[model samples]
Target: MNLVPLAAEHVSGHALLPFSVYAADGRLLLPAHAPLADVRVQAKLGRQQALFVQRADHDAWRRGLARAVDKVMQSNASLSQLAQARPDPVPPVQAPLPGEEWEHVVLALDRAVQAARRDVGWVRAVQDVQAQMRAMVCRRVDEALFYFIHTGSRRTALYSSRQALRCMLIAGEAARELGWSEERIAVLDKAALTMNVASWQLQDELVCHVGPIVDEQQRAKIDRHPAEGAWWLRHSGVTDPAWLEAVQLHHDDSLAARAPSSLTPGQEMAHLLRRVDRYSAMLSRRAGREALSATQAAQQACLGTDGKPDPTGSLMLKAVGLYPPGCFVRLASRETGIVLARGERANAPVVAALLNAEGASMAEPRLRFTTQAKHAVCTAVSPGLVHVDPPLDRMQALHVYLKSNGPAA
Candidate 1:
């Protein structure tokens, strides 16, 4: 069983517990909805390093916390509420932030990676987490891409797992666009996310590390990560040859150009993973290097080692487009905006303008269709340059926004 560390606020005295709390060793310390007033439970909690709950319930617990906050905001409740009695186990649900779901999936994926350190239940943990991602991708590819793109630009922590999520989404979407079957897509997603299982912490550190790989042992570890990761996955109950091979061969892009008819499933997945892995990493921020803009990343991701457009790279472009949703772009009008959705053509994206031509925040975000010459994408913008946060939910509801009020006037 997977367990997540809980924060103190999860069991605040002002609200009932959202989920049963557990001690580090998995003993139930407090049942769901239990009041914290019990001195016995307080005593039990005092000796533990931190509280934990089953990984699956973590979301419900979080949603409950958000619910509580919304309630307090609406009803003028506060720490003052602690003095009064309350009986409800859960606060009423509210609309979640656009990026919250991405956060949950990435957190769950991280837990699954941590679970790999154990001999038991790692596969189930990974499958459960990735299944959630696949469902999101399937339900709405646009929404999934929107959150994925929007998320990576701002967050600075958990680089390994978050990068994996980015790769998984790219690979999954690319796979589906290629008309691969459901089972194939599932295996590819699992493989893409966990391909760095051996170097999860190493990647996280190196991404933020200012200097070169000076240590010999560290260099060797980096060199051997792919093979070692595959071995660990095999030992941890991953029996799919395709999945294991993808992890081992993930760094080799040379295989990406081979004919699909002649390749084994593993080789195909490895090729896709190799390209998308690098592609995703390029778009992500690193302390030591500047991140590439969306257009640059897309171009660089698809080129072969020989400096030419590659078949696999071409597939990614065809599938995800040149300016994928949630990426930033500069318009012909000099307004800076984030791509809201892929338009009828790849070069033309639906945009939500965040900055006027002068680089000041707009009176209100204006919707633009790159299909129109006046708003055509002139260049990709650095995400860091976008200080003004755009309304993510509204962008996701682009169709409604346009129907109610057509594209930028």
Candidate 2:
């Protein structure tokens, strides 16, 4: 056997050895032909610093390595082709305009669902749909959310779609902050969008129930939705393992109990989705209960199922910030405003003032930078707390105004 350093830089995919790979102390690192993508294998190799492989298999190993390299090259070329096939970029808008973008997205989703039901594999169409979602998410998160909320809120049963979108947004923002690559972020975005599709396909009345899903039959549907969604995606020709895995495990609470060492990359993404999903569901208004305020949602997200604090929950709060965009808040000056965007600090966000300190609605919304303590958020308030004239139009106008002003420094 020949000894070789098992550094990440040198290893790309699975490295096949004719015999077992061993560490300096003679502990077997991996069996022959095992994929080296496992984090445990990588960690063990890292700790050992080197591995021994059979020299007799050098020729066979070289052949296998070449095949692996060729496969990776082909995969990358395919991904590149997909990336290059992007649709024309939507132009930046000073004001959010009425457009058929949401309708188009919904139509694409409907088509995908139909294709899945027919057992027809239309991978290209699915990819295009994901591309559209990625574009909308990157360019206009607020506008995308506006459509999701309006459409889903109109039908109580489809509220989960709104919640899913919220979770997707939060997860996307958090992933971006973590410096994940654009491609990875896109995968995350698509995964979040489709993760709950199966559940949404159920009868609207059944999914829209206000309280906890205590009925065994209903709970069964809820529990199976993740896997069902993943199965649909797979049959529709989604070959991305990470994307498929994320959809399947998005609701797996057991991930919260696993030690970090045992978590896979897929599980890590699942963990993020789970946390965001729980938080979004809590903040969402349902049949019998009022939605939790942003602050309360944040507080709830910071605790584990057992009521103890969790680091991931804390990270989620920090990522989402004190006043996430679109939420209403009362300023220290008693002026009520809607958060426009995240500011330089998590606790502070740019806000558009809808009311004065005296509680009178403003004729035109004024942009306020909450970086200054006087303008900082006092607490999250209910939407009805503000006296917004022609509330819908004013809110839309304010969103446009915020877009025009750009983010506050």
Candidate 3:
């Protein structure tokens, strides 16, 4: 597959031998006119008298070699320059830790639920136990999230493990804002964790196929599993009845009615569970459903089943801004940034500008804090169109900016 230079004087007018010629080392020297057996060839690069029949004239060979050499040199220069470049750092923002008392409760809940799921003997006790467990967990979850306000935006932080972590953080923030106690935060965290567990039971395929298929054959297997998942929770030795019910009822809101087994308490958890569960599901990118920007998702969430945007959803958007921290957004300022922190004011969400309109890196990020009266109220604009994979890696890069800024103005 190697090429060699040749003298124009070496070959005469068109002959019919195999047009291709290879050197003794199997390096192709020239394309020959005759077939391989009849074609004579010579290798110009190697020392041996390797014979070759002509394909291109000597002038054409020289021009090609020059072009190739030029390309290599240009590529090397660009790579070297890129290697030496220094980029500006994004600012950091602070997020409060989950309270100590609540943290222990979440740890215990996770441990108990995980252990019970593994123990077959506890299966029959599962429903009774999970129901109580989920209620306690739900209460604690309410407490943990009490500090930060809850909004309806698609504004979400991305991470696999952070699915649990972020849910706890946001929920804890919400609970604290609602005047929840430490125990309440723990309950909410547990509820969040349990809801995730229920979703996992549906297997991978169903969760992904949230497509528009109306036929019975398509819907048959889909309807039963959500209820079945609840049953599994009970059988698995989950001691808390509320947690069991939360798992069971989480899906109830999606369908027509709760199962006959569903109790009044279970019905309550089901409603709250759906909000948290669906919020989680929407935030995470799935297979068939188009992944939405945190803003877009929030918009859609605001537009409830009635097909009108929900007022609460607007509040969520306003609260989170159009883009929450860890979201990728295209700014009206003609820059593309990732939300590093939420603004204290409803309108401004802090951002770490990543790129200019020309898709070049910004020299230095312009921090936007909504709390400052001087800063114009920057609204949460639409998100940019970039597919985010391995969301956690991006979050690491984004966190620095978030930690430095206060809540949006």
**Which model scores highest in TM-score?**
1
Q: Write the per-residue lDDT of candidate 3 for residues 1-409, one digit (tens) a residue.
A: 2235343333332232223445444334443443323334322323445554233433344454456456656677576554433222212222224233334443444444445457654333323333443443342322222211111122222222234444545544444554557664555555555455533433344444566756675465456545655676556545566656665666664532445345454454455445544454455554454345664566555457776645434434544445556555566656666555555544466555656668777556555444454443334343335422213334333443343222334
Model 2: ten consecutive residues of lowest lDDT: 86-95
TM-score of 2: 0.66
lDDT of 3: 0.45
lDDT per residue as tens, model 1, 93-132: 3535767777888888888887787755877888888888
What is the TM-score of each predicted model, taking all chains together?
0.73, 0.66, 0.49
User: Candidate 3: worst 10 consecutive residues by lDDT?
Assistant: 143-152
Model 2 lDDT at residue 287 = 66
Better of 2 and 3 by TM-score: 2
TM-score head-to-head 1 vs 3, winner: 1
lDDT of 2 by residue, 301-321 (tens): 767668765877767766767
The order by descending lDDT is 1, 2, 3
For each predicted model, how many residue pairs clash, with residues at least 3 apart or on different chains? Answer: 0, 0, 95
| lDDT of the structure predicted as candidate 1 | 0.77
The lDDT per prediction is: 0.77, 0.65, 0.45
Cα miss at 405, model 2 (Å)?
Answer: 4.6
Which segments of model 2 are wrong by more than 4 Å? 1-111, 119-126, 142-157, 212-214, 304-309, 384-405
